[model samples]
Target: MADSQRTSEPINIVHQDEIWKAHVKLEKDSAEVWPRKWGFLTDIYKEYKMESVKMKETLKVGLPSHEVVPSLTTLQKHNHVGPSPPVPQTTQALIGWRSGHAHLQLEKYSTVHHGRRSFLKELGWPFDACY
Candidate 1:
Protein backbone atom coordinates (compact mmCIF):
# COMPACT_ATOMS: atom_id res chain seq x y z
CA MET A 1 0.00 0.00 0.00
CA ALA A 2 1.11 3.56 -0.62
CA ASP A 3 2.06 5.81 2.28
CA SER A 4 -0.29 8.59 1.20
CA GLN A 5 -3.64 8.70 2.99
CA ARG A 6 -6.83 10.75 2.74
CA THR A 7 -9.08 12.01 5.55
CA SER A 8 -12.46 11.65 3.83
CA GLU A 9 -15.38 13.73 5.10
CA PRO A 10 -15.99 13.89 8.84
CA ILE A 11 -18.41 11.22 10.00
CA ASN A 12 -21.42 12.85 11.55
CA ILE A 13 -22.31 9.68 13.39
CA VAL A 14 -26.05 9.53 13.76
CA HIS A 15 -28.00 6.33 14.45
CA GLN A 16 -26.04 5.66 17.64
CA ASP A 17 -27.67 2.33 18.46
CA GLU A 18 -26.92 0.86 15.07
CA ILE A 19 -23.34 2.13 14.99
CA TRP A 20 -22.60 0.96 18.56
CA LYS A 21 -23.91 -2.50 17.75
CA ALA A 22 -21.43 -2.72 14.90
CA HIS A 23 -18.54 -1.60 17.10
CA VAL A 24 -19.39 -4.07 19.84
CA LYS A 25 -19.66 -6.87 17.33
CA LEU A 26 -16.19 -6.28 15.96
CA GLU A 27 -14.45 -9.57 16.77
CA LYS A 28 -10.84 -10.29 17.73
CA ASP A 29 -10.07 -11.58 14.27
CA SER A 30 -11.36 -8.29 12.88
CA ALA A 31 -7.82 -6.96 12.93
CA GLU A 32 -6.91 -9.51 10.31
CA VAL A 33 -10.21 -9.22 8.44
CA TRP A 34 -10.24 -5.45 8.57
CA PRO A 35 -6.51 -4.83 8.30
CA ARG A 36 -5.15 -1.79 10.14
CA LYS A 37 -5.34 1.46 8.22
CA TRP A 38 -4.96 5.21 8.75
CA GLY A 39 -8.66 5.50 9.42
CA PHE A 40 -9.03 2.82 12.06
CA LEU A 41 -12.81 3.00 12.29
CA THR A 42 -13.00 2.11 8.61
CA ASP A 43 -11.19 -1.13 9.39
CA ILE A 44 -14.31 -2.17 11.26
CA TYR A 45 -17.75 -2.83 9.75
CA LYS A 46 -16.78 -4.35 6.44
CA GLU A 47 -18.32 -7.78 5.81
CA TYR A 48 -19.68 -8.06 9.36
CA LYS A 49 -20.72 -11.56 10.40
CA MET A 50 -23.14 -12.65 13.09
CA GLU A 51 -21.32 -14.37 15.93
CA SER A 52 -23.31 -16.75 18.12
CA VAL A 53 -20.36 -16.92 20.48
CA LYS A 54 -19.62 -14.15 22.92
CA MET A 55 -16.26 -12.36 22.79
CA LYS A 56 -14.03 -11.53 25.74
CA GLU A 57 -11.27 -9.70 23.95
CA THR A 58 -10.84 -5.97 24.18
CA LEU A 59 -9.85 -4.04 21.07
CA LYS A 60 -8.35 -0.74 22.19
CA VAL A 61 -6.74 1.89 20.02
CA GLY A 62 -5.44 5.31 20.99
CA LEU A 63 -7.54 8.44 20.38
CA PRO A 64 -7.89 10.04 16.94
CA SER A 65 -7.94 13.77 16.28
CA HIS A 66 -6.27 16.95 15.27
CA GLU A 67 -8.89 18.05 17.79
CA VAL A 68 -9.35 17.14 21.47
CA VAL A 69 -11.68 14.65 23.10
CA PRO A 70 -15.11 16.03 23.84
CA SER A 71 -16.19 16.45 27.46
CA LEU A 72 -18.50 13.79 28.90
CA THR A 73 -21.59 15.83 28.23
CA THR A 74 -20.05 17.03 25.04
CA LEU A 75 -19.47 13.44 24.00
CA GLN A 76 -23.04 12.66 24.95
CA LYS A 77 -24.15 15.54 22.81
CA HIS A 78 -21.95 14.86 19.85
CA ASN A 79 -21.89 11.06 19.89
CA HIS A 80 -25.64 10.70 20.53
CA VAL A 81 -24.84 7.23 21.90
CA GLY A 82 -26.24 7.53 25.39
CA PRO A 83 -25.84 4.82 27.98
CA SER A 84 -28.78 2.51 28.74
CA PRO A 85 -28.68 3.73 32.32
CA PRO A 86 -26.85 6.76 33.64
CA VAL A 87 -23.08 6.43 33.65
CA PRO A 88 -21.19 7.09 36.86
CA GLN A 89 -19.96 10.63 37.39
CA THR A 90 -16.50 9.30 38.17
CA THR A 91 -16.09 7.82 34.70
CA GLN A 92 -17.66 10.83 33.05
CA ALA A 93 -14.62 13.04 32.82
CA LEU A 94 -12.46 10.17 31.64
CA ILE A 95 -14.94 9.68 28.83
CA GLY A 96 -12.94 11.85 26.52
CA TRP A 97 -10.28 10.78 24.04
CA ARG A 98 -8.65 7.51 25.01
CA SER A 99 -11.52 5.98 26.97
CA GLY A 100 -14.31 7.16 24.71
CA HIS A 101 -12.78 7.21 21.25
CA ALA A 102 -10.19 4.47 21.66
CA HIS A 103 -12.54 2.21 23.67
CA LEU A 104 -10.04 1.27 26.38
CA GLN A 105 -9.50 1.56 30.11
CA LEU A 106 -7.76 4.76 31.19
CA GLU A 107 -4.71 2.84 32.38
CA LYS A 108 -4.37 0.78 29.20
CA TYR A 109 -4.13 3.76 26.87
CA SER A 110 -2.55 7.23 26.93
CA THR A 111 -1.54 9.94 24.49
CA VAL A 112 1.68 10.44 26.45
CA HIS A 113 2.48 6.76 26.27
CA HIS A 114 1.08 5.46 23.01
CA GLY A 115 0.06 8.46 20.92
CA ARG A 116 3.56 9.86 20.78
CA ARG A 117 4.92 6.70 19.24
CA SER A 118 6.17 7.33 15.70
CA PHE A 119 3.42 5.44 13.90
CA LEU A 120 0.79 7.56 15.69
CA LYS A 121 2.54 10.91 15.41
CA GLU A 122 0.77 11.95 12.24
CA LEU A 123 -2.65 11.52 13.81
CA GLY A 124 -2.36 14.80 15.66
CA TRP A 125 -4.60 15.80 18.56
CA PRO A 126 -4.72 18.64 21.04
CA PHE A 127 -2.62 18.51 24.22
CA ASP A 128 -5.69 18.11 26.45
CA ALA A 129 -5.54 14.29 26.38
CA CYS A 130 -1.81 14.23 27.05
CA TYR A 131 -0.69 12.93 30.42
Candidate 2:
Protein backbone atom coordinates (compact mmCIF):
# COMPACT_ATOMS: atom_id res chain seq x y z
CA MET A 1 0.00 0.00 0.00
CA ALA A 2 1.28 3.48 -0.94
CA ASP A 3 1.93 5.94 1.97
CA SER A 4 1.15 8.94 -0.28
CA GLN A 5 -2.35 10.53 -0.35
CA ARG A 6 -4.24 10.49 -3.67
CA THR A 7 -7.05 12.73 -4.93
CA SER A 8 -10.25 11.09 -6.21
CA GLU A 9 -12.13 12.05 -9.39
CA PRO A 10 -15.14 14.45 -9.17
CA ILE A 11 -18.31 12.63 -8.04
CA ASN A 12 -21.08 11.94 -10.55
CA ILE A 13 -24.71 10.83 -10.03
CA VAL A 14 -23.80 7.20 -9.28
CA HIS A 15 -21.16 8.31 -6.72
CA GLN A 16 -23.61 10.71 -5.12
CA ASP A 17 -26.27 7.98 -4.94
CA GLU A 18 -23.78 5.63 -3.28
CA ILE A 19 -22.80 8.36 -0.77
CA TRP A 20 -26.44 9.06 0.05
CA LYS A 21 -27.18 5.36 0.48
CA ALA A 22 -24.16 5.03 2.80
CA HIS A 23 -25.33 8.05 4.86
CA VAL A 24 -28.88 6.62 5.17
CA LYS A 25 -27.47 3.20 6.13
CA LEU A 26 -25.24 4.83 8.80
CA GLU A 27 -28.21 6.75 10.26
CA LYS A 28 -30.32 3.55 10.34
CA ASP A 29 -27.51 1.66 12.06
CA SER A 30 -27.04 4.44 14.63
CA ALA A 31 -30.76 4.61 15.36
CA GLU A 32 -30.89 0.84 15.93
CA VAL A 33 -27.68 0.81 18.03
CA TRP A 34 -28.40 3.78 20.32
CA PRO A 35 -31.47 5.10 22.12
CA ARG A 36 -32.81 8.48 21.02
CA LYS A 37 -32.32 11.45 23.36
CA TRP A 38 -35.33 13.06 25.08
CA GLY A 39 -37.19 15.59 22.85
CA PHE A 40 -36.98 19.34 23.62
CA LEU A 41 -40.61 19.73 24.73
CA THR A 42 -40.41 16.51 26.76
CA ASP A 43 -37.34 17.78 28.64
CA ILE A 44 -39.01 21.13 29.32
CA TYR A 45 -42.14 19.42 30.69
CA LYS A 46 -39.99 17.14 32.87
CA GLU A 47 -38.15 20.16 34.35
CA TYR A 48 -41.43 22.03 34.95
CA LYS A 49 -43.00 19.02 36.68
CA MET A 50 -39.91 18.53 38.89
CA GLU A 51 -39.83 22.22 39.83
CA SER A 52 -43.57 22.24 40.56
CA VAL A 53 -43.16 19.30 42.99
CA LYS A 54 -40.26 21.06 44.78
CA MET A 55 -42.25 24.29 44.97
CA LYS A 56 -45.25 22.42 46.44
CA GLU A 57 -43.02 21.04 49.17
CA THR A 58 -41.56 24.50 49.89
CA LEU A 59 -45.01 26.15 49.92
CA LYS A 60 -46.23 23.59 52.55
CA VAL A 61 -43.90 25.37 55.02
CA GLY A 62 -45.72 28.70 54.27
CA LEU A 63 -42.91 30.67 52.58
CA PRO A 64 -43.54 34.43 52.03
CA SER A 65 -45.11 35.49 48.68
CA HIS A 66 -42.06 37.63 47.88
CA GLU A 67 -39.75 34.57 48.17
CA VAL A 68 -41.94 32.38 45.93
CA VAL A 69 -40.64 31.53 42.42
CA PRO A 70 -42.20 33.55 39.62
CA SER A 71 -44.53 31.86 37.10
CA LEU A 72 -43.31 31.12 33.50
CA THR A 73 -45.59 33.85 32.08
CA THR A 74 -44.21 36.40 34.53
CA LEU A 75 -40.62 35.39 33.60
CA GLN A 76 -41.39 35.69 29.87
CA LYS A 77 -42.95 39.14 30.29
CA HIS A 78 -39.97 40.46 32.31
CA ASN A 79 -37.54 38.93 29.76
CA HIS A 80 -39.26 40.79 26.86
CA VAL A 81 -40.23 37.48 25.22
CA GLY A 82 -44.00 38.16 25.13
CA PRO A 83 -44.40 41.57 23.42
CA SER A 84 -41.92 42.61 20.75
CA PRO A 85 -39.83 45.82 20.99
CA PRO A 86 -41.02 48.91 19.05
CA VAL A 87 -39.87 49.18 15.42
CA PRO A 88 -37.50 52.07 14.70
CA GLN A 89 -38.85 55.00 12.57
CA THR A 90 -35.81 55.01 10.23
CA THR A 91 -32.65 53.06 9.40
CA GLN A 92 -30.65 55.96 10.87
CA ALA A 93 -32.41 55.28 14.18
CA LEU A 94 -31.13 51.67 14.05
CA ILE A 95 -27.55 50.81 15.07
CA GLY A 96 -26.03 48.93 12.10
CA TRP A 97 -24.78 49.47 8.50
CA ARG A 98 -26.64 46.31 7.29
CA SER A 99 -29.92 47.73 8.64
CA GLY A 100 -29.32 51.05 6.82
CA HIS A 101 -28.81 49.30 3.46
CA ALA A 102 -31.78 46.98 4.05
CA HIS A 103 -34.11 49.84 5.06
CA LEU A 104 -33.01 51.91 2.02
CA GLN A 105 -33.87 49.00 -0.28
CA LEU A 106 -37.20 48.49 1.56
CA GLU A 107 -38.06 52.23 1.27
CA LYS A 108 -37.27 52.16 -2.47
CA TYR A 109 -39.46 49.05 -2.89
CA SER A 110 -42.37 50.62 -0.94
CA THR A 111 -42.18 53.86 -2.98
CA VAL A 112 -42.16 51.88 -6.27
CA HIS A 113 -45.17 49.81 -5.18
CA HIS A 114 -47.13 52.29 -3.01
CA GLY A 115 -46.57 55.76 -4.60
CA ARG A 116 -49.41 57.76 -6.19
CA ARG A 117 -50.12 56.50 -9.79
CA SER A 118 -47.92 53.58 -8.84
CA PHE A 119 -46.83 50.63 -11.05
CA LEU A 120 -49.86 48.56 -9.99
CA LYS A 121 -52.30 51.32 -11.03
CA GLU A 122 -50.44 51.92 -14.34
CA LEU A 123 -50.81 48.16 -15.06
CA GLY A 124 -54.60 48.41 -14.38
CA TRP A 125 -54.53 46.55 -11.01
CA PRO A 126 -58.10 45.18 -10.96
CA PHE A 127 -57.80 43.83 -14.51
CA ASP A 128 -54.19 42.64 -14.15
CA ALA A 129 -54.90 40.92 -10.76
CA CYS A 130 -54.90 37.35 -12.15
CA TYR A 131 -51.46 37.71 -13.77
Candidate 3:
Protein backbone atom coordinates (compact mmCIF):
# COMPACT_ATOMS: atom_id res chain seq x y z
CA MET A 1 0.00 0.00 0.00
CA ALA A 2 1.14 3.54 -0.63
CA ASP A 3 2.32 5.42 2.43
CA SER A 4 -0.29 7.67 4.02
CA GLN A 5 0.76 10.92 5.59
CA ARG A 6 -1.15 13.53 7.56
CA THR A 7 -2.16 16.51 5.46
CA SER A 8 -0.58 18.86 7.99
CA GLU A 9 2.79 18.98 9.72
CA PRO A 10 3.42 16.40 12.40
CA ILE A 11 3.18 17.50 16.04
CA ASN A 12 4.59 16.00 19.23
CA ILE A 13 1.84 15.09 21.72
CA VAL A 14 4.34 14.97 24.57
CA HIS A 15 5.19 18.70 24.23
CA GLN A 16 2.46 20.47 26.18
CA ASP A 17 3.78 23.92 25.11
CA GLU A 18 3.85 23.19 21.38
CA ILE A 19 0.99 24.33 19.17
CA TRP A 20 -0.46 22.23 16.34
CA LYS A 21 -0.98 23.92 13.00
CA ALA A 22 -2.52 22.84 9.71
CA HIS A 23 -2.42 24.87 6.52
CA VAL A 24 -4.81 24.63 3.65
CA LYS A 25 -4.16 26.29 0.30
CA LEU A 26 -7.09 27.93 -1.31
CA GLU A 27 -7.65 27.75 -5.08
CA LYS A 28 -10.33 28.70 -7.54
CA ASP A 29 -12.65 25.85 -8.42
CA SER A 30 -15.14 25.51 -11.24
CA ALA A 31 -18.80 25.14 -10.39
CA GLU A 32 -22.09 24.67 -12.23
CA VAL A 33 -25.13 26.83 -11.54
CA TRP A 34 -28.60 27.15 -12.96
CA PRO A 35 -29.23 30.02 -15.36
CA ARG A 36 -32.37 32.13 -15.29
CA LYS A 37 -35.07 32.51 -18.01
CA TRP A 38 -35.01 28.95 -19.28
CA GLY A 39 -36.10 25.55 -17.96
CA PHE A 40 -33.52 22.81 -17.63
CA LEU A 41 -34.70 20.62 -20.50
CA THR A 42 -35.60 23.66 -22.59
CA ASP A 43 -32.17 25.24 -22.20
CA ILE A 44 -30.61 22.63 -24.44
CA TYR A 45 -33.38 23.21 -26.94
CA LYS A 46 -32.63 26.91 -26.95
CA GLU A 47 -28.93 26.24 -27.36
CA TYR A 48 -29.72 24.07 -30.34
CA LYS A 49 -31.79 26.86 -31.88
CA MET A 50 -29.07 29.47 -31.40
CA GLU A 51 -26.38 27.14 -32.65
CA SER A 52 -28.38 26.56 -35.80
CA VAL A 53 -28.50 30.29 -36.45
CA LYS A 54 -24.76 30.64 -35.93
CA MET A 55 -24.17 27.72 -38.22
CA LYS A 56 -26.13 29.44 -40.96
CA GLU A 57 -24.11 32.62 -40.50
CA THR A 58 -20.89 30.63 -40.69
CA LEU A 59 -22.02 29.07 -43.95
CA LYS A 60 -22.93 32.48 -45.34
CA VAL A 61 -19.41 33.72 -44.68
CA GLY A 62 -17.97 30.60 -46.35
CA LEU A 63 -16.08 29.44 -43.31
CA PRO A 64 -13.92 26.41 -44.06
CA SER A 65 -14.64 24.45 -40.89
CA HIS A 66 -17.91 24.13 -39.06
CA GLU A 67 -15.80 24.11 -35.90
CA VAL A 68 -15.34 27.83 -36.55
CA VAL A 69 -18.84 28.34 -35.34
CA PRO A 70 -18.53 30.10 -31.99
CA SER A 71 -21.27 28.04 -30.43
CA LEU A 72 -19.66 24.78 -31.54
CA THR A 73 -16.21 25.77 -30.28
CA THR A 74 -17.36 27.29 -27.00
CA LEU A 75 -18.03 24.01 -25.21
CA GLN A 76 -17.06 24.15 -21.55
CA LYS A 77 -13.94 22.15 -20.78
CA HIS A 78 -14.73 21.58 -17.10
CA ASN A 79 -18.34 21.29 -16.16
CA HIS A 80 -18.80 19.57 -12.80
CA VAL A 81 -22.18 18.13 -13.75
CA GLY A 82 -21.49 17.42 -17.41
CA PRO A 83 -20.91 13.92 -18.77
CA SER A 84 -17.61 12.16 -18.39
CA PRO A 85 -15.10 12.56 -21.31
CA PRO A 86 -16.77 15.95 -21.77
CA VAL A 87 -19.51 16.32 -24.33
CA PRO A 88 -18.80 18.76 -27.15
CA GLN A 89 -21.18 21.63 -27.86
CA THR A 90 -21.91 20.40 -31.37
CA THR A 91 -22.67 16.92 -30.05
CA GLN A 92 -24.91 18.41 -27.40
CA ALA A 93 -26.71 20.47 -30.03
CA LEU A 94 -27.28 17.37 -32.08
CA ILE A 95 -28.61 15.60 -29.03
CA GLY A 96 -31.00 18.45 -28.36
CA TRP A 97 -32.21 18.36 -31.94
CA ARG A 98 -32.72 14.63 -31.76
CA SER A 99 -34.56 14.95 -28.46
CA GLY A 100 -36.97 17.47 -29.96
CA HIS A 101 -37.43 15.22 -32.96
CA ALA A 102 -38.16 12.31 -30.62
CA HIS A 103 -40.96 14.26 -28.99
CA LEU A 104 -42.54 14.73 -32.37
CA GLN A 105 -42.17 11.02 -33.01
CA LEU A 106 -43.85 10.26 -29.72
CA GLU A 107 -46.74 12.53 -30.59
CA LYS A 108 -47.07 10.73 -33.91
CA TYR A 109 -46.99 7.37 -32.14
CA SER A 110 -49.72 8.54 -29.78
CA THR A 111 -52.21 8.36 -32.62
CA VAL A 112 -51.69 4.61 -32.56
CA HIS A 113 -51.02 3.98 -28.87
CA HIS A 114 -53.75 6.30 -27.57
CA GLY A 115 -56.35 5.48 -30.16
CA ARG A 116 -58.41 3.39 -27.77
CA ARG A 117 -58.20 6.02 -25.01
CA SER A 118 -59.31 8.74 -27.42
CA PHE A 119 -62.16 6.57 -28.69
CA LEU A 120 -63.33 5.87 -25.14
CA LYS A 121 -63.17 9.55 -24.23
CA GLU A 122 -65.22 10.46 -27.30
CA LEU A 123 -67.85 8.00 -26.16
CA GLY A 124 -68.16 9.89 -22.82
CA TRP A 125 -66.09 7.44 -20.76
CA PRO A 126 -65.36 9.94 -17.97
CA PHE A 127 -61.85 9.73 -16.50
CA ASP A 128 -60.30 11.46 -13.54
CA ALA A 129 -57.89 14.18 -14.58
CA CYS A 130 -54.51 14.36 -12.91
CA TYR A 131 -51.05 15.58 -13.77
Q: Residues 1-131, candidate 1, lDDT per residue (tens digit)?
A: 33235456554457767788788678645765664544555434442322212221343445568566667987676665434434547865645534553444446445554444542355576555566
Clashing pairs in 1: none
For model 3, the local distance difference test gives: 0.51
lDDT of each: 0.52, 0.68, 0.51
Better of 1 and 3 by TM-score: 3
Where model 2 places Cα greater than 4 Å from the true spot, the runs are 1-11, 36-131
lDDT of 1 at 80: 50
Report the poorest 10 consecutive residues by lDDT, candidate 3. Answer: 22-31
Of the two candidates 1 and 2, the one with more favorable TM-score, higher being better, is 2
For lDDT, the strongest prediction is 2
Q: Estimate each model's TM-score.
A: 0.13, 0.27, 0.17
lDDT of 3 by residue, 12-51 (tens): 5756343322211111111122234235667789899999
> Poorest 10 consecutive residues of model 1 by lDDT?
47-56
Better of 1 and 2 by lDDT: 2
Which regions of candidate 3 fall more than 4 Å away from where they truly are? 1-38, 61-131
